[model samples]
Target chain A: MQMEATIAQSVSEKVKTSGAEAVIRSLLAEKVDLLFGYPGGAIMPVYDALFHYQQALKHVLTRHEQGAIHAAQGYARATGKVGVVMATSGPGATNLITGIADAMIDSTPLVCITGQVGSHLLGTDAFQETDIISISMPCTKWNFQVTKAEEIPAALAKAFYIAQSGRPGPVLIDITKDAQFGEVEFEYSPCQNVRSYKPEPPINPEAIEQAAELINSAKRPFVLFGQGVILGQAEEEFKSFIEKTGIPAASTLLGLSALPTDHPLNVGMLGMHGNYGPNKLTNECDVLIAIGMRFDDRVTGDLSRYAVQAKVIHLDIDPSEINKNVKVQVPVLGNCKETLKHLTQAVKRKSHQAWLEQFRAYDQIEHEQVIEPELKPLGPELTMGEVIRQVNELARGEAILVTDVGQHQMVACRYTHFKQTKSNITSGGLGTMGFCLPAALGAKLGTPDREVVAVIGDGGFQMTLQELGTIFQTKAAVKIIILNNSFLGMVRQWQQLFFDKRYSSTEMVNPDFVKIAEGYGIKGRSIKQRSQLKEAVAEMLDHKESYLLEVHVGKEDNVFPMVPTGASVSDVRLS
Target chain B: MCKDFTITVFTEDHIGLLNRITSVFTRRHLNIESLNTSESQIPGIHRFTIVLNTTEEIVQKIVLQLEKQVEVIKAVYHLDEETVFQEITLFKVSVEQAAQHNLVERLIRDKNARILSVEQDFMIIEKTGHKAENDDLLEFLRPFGLIDYVKSGRVSLIKPDEELKNLHELVNEAKQANNNQSFN
Candidate 1:
């Protein structure tokens, strides 16, 4: 009886299937439950296959191809799993370029499948044909073009593996239409090895010891971490490492929510609009340990004058990032989860009371100069910071805060509180506008239990507002707060600070955003008065469905603690 | 601070890898002086030899970026003084012009060039040397009505190491261990 069953299973597994069906089966094998995409001519066969598999694979039809990709990014960031995106050739594939680049720089894992023209017509300028594999080469971690149906199963298996392994980034697999329609014997085995790709470097005990010794003997050691901790799922390990040493830590923009916002040693955000304490004290620390974060120019400010007084220790999964930016004294290369555990075991428990107090002193100065006025402004006009403060009060650090670019993004990053890892999703690397609306919808889908709030500026809100249809269709229950300044706020701030305040095409004659949301059948409110702020935010949050709240904020309000271009972090402004 | 450097990359043989590798240079606005690719000593693996003139800092960054490519196993850059390198150039000259200039024959023989073919209309001579030597021969042949000339990119071997072999052995051992663990 057992032999008969085994033979039957083998026979069933060897059944012939179309390449499009194989692609669906491969996704099933990878345990992909949700997909974000748009349907078009080149991808019609795959969409046809998808119809029969709707019960198993849920597909969200985003309004635009760019919206689909960004939504996939949000899903990946929220769930810590590989996000999947599908789009047709040409413009459909090109629309994914921004989000692909964003995923690459931020290390979000995504597997993007783009349909191409028929194999015979690939280079012949067939309708909807574009060389996406070549176009995405610079951005994707790896990419392949599949011209034969027989290659579908293996190509998709490899795509999932490459996209999710070792310093994860987006991977593109372009399939010709003929290949999708052709028949093949479907078989799949998850790729275990690629021969050429080594995802994780072996941890060196000696390097761990060297880093520990440096940390132990240092007068003041500071930790600057990025999304690596969360990407590696090493948040607990990171917390233990910092808590044992009692060293105050700051985070790069994407690194927020990896460590609890209210943790004793959690200092603040780091970058151009970062807190005054971390920026000012960067030069004062004797030892700087950077984990899972590259020293971006925004974070480091002037490299020549940044952390020159410190002996740096960098722990990262990517070896190329070790000396690519600021030079490090000890380089620990491996998954930070394992590396942090090993380092935590090696380092001694100690406290830097005086060093921590120095941060508090600067924090006090910053609160007086920057934070207090913005969050609790005496001015009649609403401030972006106050809207964030209200949302933080209502959500209580539980909501997933997804933000778009510009002043609202900085303000939300500055004021939003997060208690759990992966709770803060934003366009960190690309600074992409119009990212919040669709990304919030995707985040809500990925983590259905969490409240996903999107804080967007007036200018950015208009970019992807078409996604209100997506919200209405899916009923994603995303809470969107638009800080309406009626200007391209960040550029205006820059012009005010450096460009002599000549707002060149920065002002906007806006539309009725609430009416637009209502047109899409989503509930919304437009508020300008401070008295209505609390109830308006509460109403948006309390609504059973997705809601939009547009608050009129100060038009010329600028984000402070700014590190002027080419200036040192110590010279961060507080106006 | 700009100086000539040779970068050798060991990678898995895969389609589109060359594009992936070159785009790193293209993105940085760095121009390649020459580039060559072929199978390496190890079975199934490919090697890339690229020559460029850039600041050491920029070259180091470029090599690091190249190593970041998925198919690329390893990438290392070497200063000109650290490696022995040469390029193979083929010159096709008009037979009539070559016979008119007796000095061309002497120059070819003096430079250790070999006559590969002699057709009625053209003669083909091959020379293997560094860029300077190849350029000198080209200038000499230009007066002899050089019909066509083509030179391959620099092919180099590091002076004091067989690092590629060592890396291959290490990779093999790692693969073996992974297989054993999976079986268990």
Candidate 2:
């Protein structure tokens, strides 16, 4: 340790470094390998410094700033590390707003660095200058601006710490141009503690005891978890706790892959368009143990009627989230791993076979009414579920599945199977349409050994279709599957069901996605008929390089088992 | 349900924290009527007083959201009757009006305002009072040649019994926490 310290000191003294160089050194100190960014005038100095550190780090030049940030989110989601994104001020910074907001609501950890105009020109409305810190304030977990060269390392350390710590979310650091170019006596020390911030608040022993006692005494217990399980990297802990108690577990869309989809205890997804059983049984469960899931409005439709019969025990790391929505009878404020461990130790070993069987009965009903028909449709028009079904079989439920937001995202989340943890990534809260392509690129890069597949809708695919250039440059082996229905299917479905079929602007006339893939120097296949689905998907998956498979799905198909707008979760439709 | 609500927040002086704090109002679609920020008596601590027109429910939610901010020490909302507050208004008027008529002097006497400066082009007058009193003085001075006018947001102090002890305790705890940390 002394020798390493001496070496670090000598290295710092050898280089009379600018703040840009300090930024690179700090990132290296933090051991960040991959960076997604775009270059502009304000951030050019950092890019210049980045050129020197190219040997040690990998910088992915995405087509747009949004792509860069989303890709960083993908990297973070895949690696459970802080994703790093760099962009210039104004337009470059503003372009990251959607991604930042997406990462914020979805709890993706990202460290975004934006370059600002000189500090002296901040308020004068200098060229290409925008109040990025102010603009990103609501969306970021923590954000700071550094004008002095000496503050660069500390700001960056804090940014990374805040981004990755406690219910992880995006954090932004705005660096002034003068600071980037100004020289400083560089010394990098990682941020350990923030006086005003407490990432992990102390856990309440009484809450855990009450939770355990409730779980033990319950005649019918249920477990509903979400991305918090994945965020805490507590899949093993959660599995142990659930298996010990024999509680039926339902996952939020973001929590899909935290446990094996095929696991007997893993009930199904819980929300609109979710499995029939979880939504129906939510009202009947006696003791609902919600772990690491914020009861989003989508999950708790008609909040007054949601889980009203049950006594809820919610274990989460964020204290503010405890009673923000659904009331919790026992609020265990801690990370899922710690809270579950404590609860598991005290909980009585019991099985609720009767309660578990009720979920299976619901699953049977959904399978016959919705799942079977969607996965094996009789109509001439192919379905998104069939395509996902084929991908599920070919990928053997092991591939990392990334989906853009829309009908396809829901379809993928509903149908795709994952045998391992961290295999599912999507924009759940923000519902950003163009998240898949760039995110897939980052996912493939982050987990290069694993099979990476991106499921997107034609509408969403076109939103960030420009990232094909990124794929062409990086040669990422991400299998792109576009469920092309030639319309905004989700919106079209809502119109069909709720808006008196006012189609209006929901229709779309798209180009040949195959031709577009060909133009980007990627192999492509198109399947228009149901008969051609298996062969085309097989061919796309078998191809050596990156491949795009466009499956023409039914245009007017509506996602079923949906709780109608402002309706109770128990009122899910099977149509 | 829509009535004026004042929210006071104690926090550390972190750059862009004001933006982060204000963004909560923006996200909830609540309009900020007035905002004032200044250093607190406790060293290294800052306080922000934000006024908005919102329902009791929305104000409660806003305070909760504000307290969730990493830099924010504490946040609470107050009704009109709960706090003793004042806004300082500076009225700049044409010098000719002050010289010609005793109207300016008489108004100043009646309003309990003091002349800040007498310039060649304009004379500056300062008034400290509740928002209504300041507005009333402005209305009376409207007949006079007014050059410019500015009013600060409500600088509020909570009633002794209503003042939060938790905030002061939290600030002290934060200081103690920082002192124990050896990272610096």
**Tens digit of per-residue lDDT, candidate 1, span B51-151:** 99999988888888888787787888999888899999999989888888774558556988989998999888998999999899999888778889999
lDDT of each: 0.90, 0.89
Clashing pairs in 2: none
lDDT of 2: 0.89
Off by over 4 Å in 2: A1-15, B1-6, B52-57, B78-152, B158-165, B179-184
Per-candidate TM-scores read 0.96, 0.90
Q: Evaluate residue B150 in candidate 2 and report its C-alpha lDDT on the 0 to 100 scale.
A: 98
True contacts kept of 2: 0.46
- Candidate 1: docking tier: acceptable
lDDT of 1 at B57: 88
For candidate 2, write residues B1-184 as lDDT tens digits.
7998889998988777788888888877778999999998788889999999989877877887787787887788999888899999999988888677776668667889889998789989999999999999899888789878999999888775635666677778887777222232
Question: lDDT tens string, model 2, A447-499?
Answer: 99888999999999999999999999999988999998989999999988888
**Backbone clashes in model 2:** 0
After TM-score superposition, the amount by which residue A174's alpha carbon in candidate 1 deviates from its true location, in angstroms, is 0.9
